[model samples]
Target chain A: MNNMRVLAEEEETSDGVEVTWEDQQQINTFAKLNARLKGIEDKLEQLKQEKEALDDLSTELELTDEDQTVLYKLGESFLHLPQPDALVRLEIDQASVSSQLAKLGAVAEECERGMKDLKVRLYAKFGKAINLDE
Target chain B: MVEQKFPESLDKNPRGIPKAPFIANVEEYIGGPDGDVEGPLKDFQDAIAKYRYMDGSLTQRRKGLEDKIPDIRKTLQMVEFLKQRRDRKQKADDQEDDLEEDDENSEGAKKPLTTTFELNDTLFAEAQLDDTDTVYLWLGANVMLSYEIPEAITLLRSKLDAAETSLKTAIEDLEFVREQLTVMEVNTARMYNWDVKRRRERRSAEEAAKREKES
Candidate 1:
């Protein structure tokens, strides 16, 4: 077990690609960038879903009377609505939702731009012959 | 449904992975005489190269798993949030009913009061959350699956578990490779020592033989 621990520590110490293997280092970096790109893509997908869901829910809620009682979960618990005025829990505000959607769109655009830059760097390192599509 | 336009930069590697070089014989280099340690020397270099490659691959795999685990954990957190919201709503409903009973004689109690959400919070997107019994799970590589709330939770839990297990396995494999490299290092050192000693012995023997001939 002690030997294995030492081995494990040694492995951890050399976890990064060695500088001697220039090609391998480049390839490993490409992999890391690829993973990060995937993560950003996932976030973009999620934000799109959230915006869509919010739009659908807002349209559905607007068709009803403003004072109509609805279940609103605020914080940890749901608050009861006796009057039509105080919608303390519902997230049905139009301006706020629109801003959120716009913000997400901008973020997605930024991520795409970053990905493009990363690809350019990768191509520069591996050259045109290196197939990034594989 | 919104159509997804995947970024072009996220495309796959074009050239694919290059193949690693193979070493034919490693053991033949060991336990050889002095001055003929070139085979063992080559073997030592090959072993170091192989170890580096293995370590590099394992490192990448471990990093991938690490990234995946946190994302799955975030999914789990969302699931827990939904569950808590539902439970809170149920509790509130029970309390409202109890209040209605106490104010049975009042005109305000004529209609059962229902609470709906309406907010303009900066931290969260403002949108009415109708009770949902389902959630969408991202299954990686641009794949998303819709599952019932309970099912989504179960799936994420399993995914997190699987990712953790894979990470553990990769670490173990890396350690094993490191151990092999260490053994190779020891063997090379011992072989060099043996070669040096043999050369000294041979030089002394040659001197004794020449001296006897001169006598």
Candidate 2:
């Protein structure tokens, strides 16, 4: 057990630097940024999926006649409305979803930029000792 | 439900024995005029790497099982609650008809279960669950199916049992992997110490021979 502990410690400091307070702070910041980036990426992926589903629905709606009454899901119930009204509602939803996706994409880009800057600083200080990538 | 089967390799070793053989005498284990310790050290390193990889995957599997168990339990609870509420309403209705034909009393006895359900996000709306023999369950991929109360309960119960059994197996596999890791680490440490001792003895013996020639 004692030998195992020593071996584990060696692996941690294998980059050949004794961890100082400043270095530890930088490491923690990198971890926090990485986690935030991951969350944003997940949201971005989900929004993309939502956009694809909405597009498919729009294509199907275009094939239906304007005089037909279409069923639109609202909350827990369905609303039977004219095809024109349903198309308008779908258009409004698609617009909102697209705007949200754009905003998330911009934020994700900013996050990636920040991570890159941090990576450069960390690598400069620790050389090959610190691992910044997942 | 299908029976849960763990890997045969993990199940084969009931006794906790190190996969790598222990070096009783390090000198004899690496016996040679040159004392070639590199080959044995490389073998030990490979075994440790293999064990570490197994440990990593086992830990991930254990985590997945842990997350799924709670979801199964929650679903089971919901189904059981629905079944209980249906049974209670049925009993109340039968008693009201048998005892008296009072309209007001019958209305009170057949009162529906009122609750709030989420509309979207944080928004919710008040709703009442009327007397119904069937409930719909979302079977993923946009498909939903209606099943009677008794049938739903049985299905949920069976699913819960299977998830629980799988979780137990995952936990056992994780423990077995950890034990193997410890044994491999101890073997590596022993081999390393033996090599250092052998090198020191060789150096001191050479110095002694030089001193005798100077005298």
Candidate 3:
């Protein structure tokens, strides 16, 4: 957290250009939020890819005979199950992945909202003097 | 504002050793009678650039670890799963032996675990998984070695721990490098401000002296 803290000192003669510690702190918070949002975005992308893979597997499973023993990958290992059972398992996995994606998407939205609030406050105070864009 | 004066560097010891104090008083910190500003500013710029470079590499390292940790965990999970399945099969075989002696032929006729495996991108092949006591693992660099279930589990566990430790270190190093970069940037700003103040004061004093001589 020390790395996140900006220098906190008051300057007597500001000339409207000096970055007050408060502004610096807001900037730091914005930056931290930005990084967090980026991480969440990356995770969302990965989860989306996983969901796509699951969808492809589901399609493949549907084409197999009803009594055929299809393989459903659980964790890193595959489970041999009847076609219907495999479809059910794949649905469950897809649901779990979709839920994860939704959760991350919500968290990313919250992070973006927080960044927007900080941008508003900081921009109000510093105007063109600050560069809060990523 | 004065009451909020905290230590310039928030973390006292980021890497288990204290860092040199941030340049609090830029004029004095730069250290020249005439308030030599350019040289120290240039040095700070170079240092900031170095720190930025380090941050870039550390970020990449962190990403690599992030990708690797999950991969190791997945491999470890597979190994453990295989071991468990093998143990269960062994237990069932033992139980069957105790229950009946005539079931020996049926054991040989038992159905293999059939699965579809990807042979290449989007190309799948149907394969039967045989009940085996050993599994082959890729050890990287064109090397593949077979290990018994228990041995593979132990090896993978150790490797996962090492990878996790390295990931922790990489993240900490990235944070430290970013903090250093921030400190350098703040120093540069402060030095520039101090130089501007000095020049303005000197100019005002010169104007006052000229007016006194004329009067």
Q: TM-score of A-chain in each prediction?
A: 0.50, 0.83, 0.80
Can you list each candidate's DockQ? 0.09, 0.02, 0.19
Top TM-score model: 3
Clashing pairs in 2: none
- Residue B214 miss distance in model 3 (angstroms): 6.0
TM-score of each: 0.45, 0.52, 0.67
DockQ value of candidate 1 = 0.09
lDDT tens digits, residue span B46-79, model 2: 7678768877886788678767766766666556
Candidates sorted on TM-score, descending: 3, 2, 1
- Please state the error at residue B14 of candidate 1 in Å: 34
What is chain B's TM-score across the candidates, in the order shown? 0.65, 0.76, 0.83
| Over 4 Å off, model 2 | A1-134, B1-11, B14-35, B102-109, B119-121, B139-143
CAPRI level of candidate 2: incorrect
Q: Candidate 1 residues B90-135, lDDT tens each?
A: 6665766887543322333333334333344333333435677788
Q: Rank the candidates by lDDT, best first.
A: 3, 2, 1
Per-residue lDDT over A19-127 for candidate 1, one digit per residue giving the tens place of the 0 to 100 score: 2234434444444445445645765576667667766765666676764555444332344543332232235444544675677567556645665665676667546
Most lDDT-accurate candidate: 3
lDDT of 3 by residue, B1-215 (tens): 12212234445554542232367666566655475787777777766777778778878988898888888877876677567557756766777779865453334334566666667777877778788889898999999999998998999899989988897787667656665666678877777767766766676799999999999
Please give the distance, in angstroms, between residue A90's alpha carbon in candidate 3 and its true position after superposition.
4.4
On DockQ, the leading prediction is 3
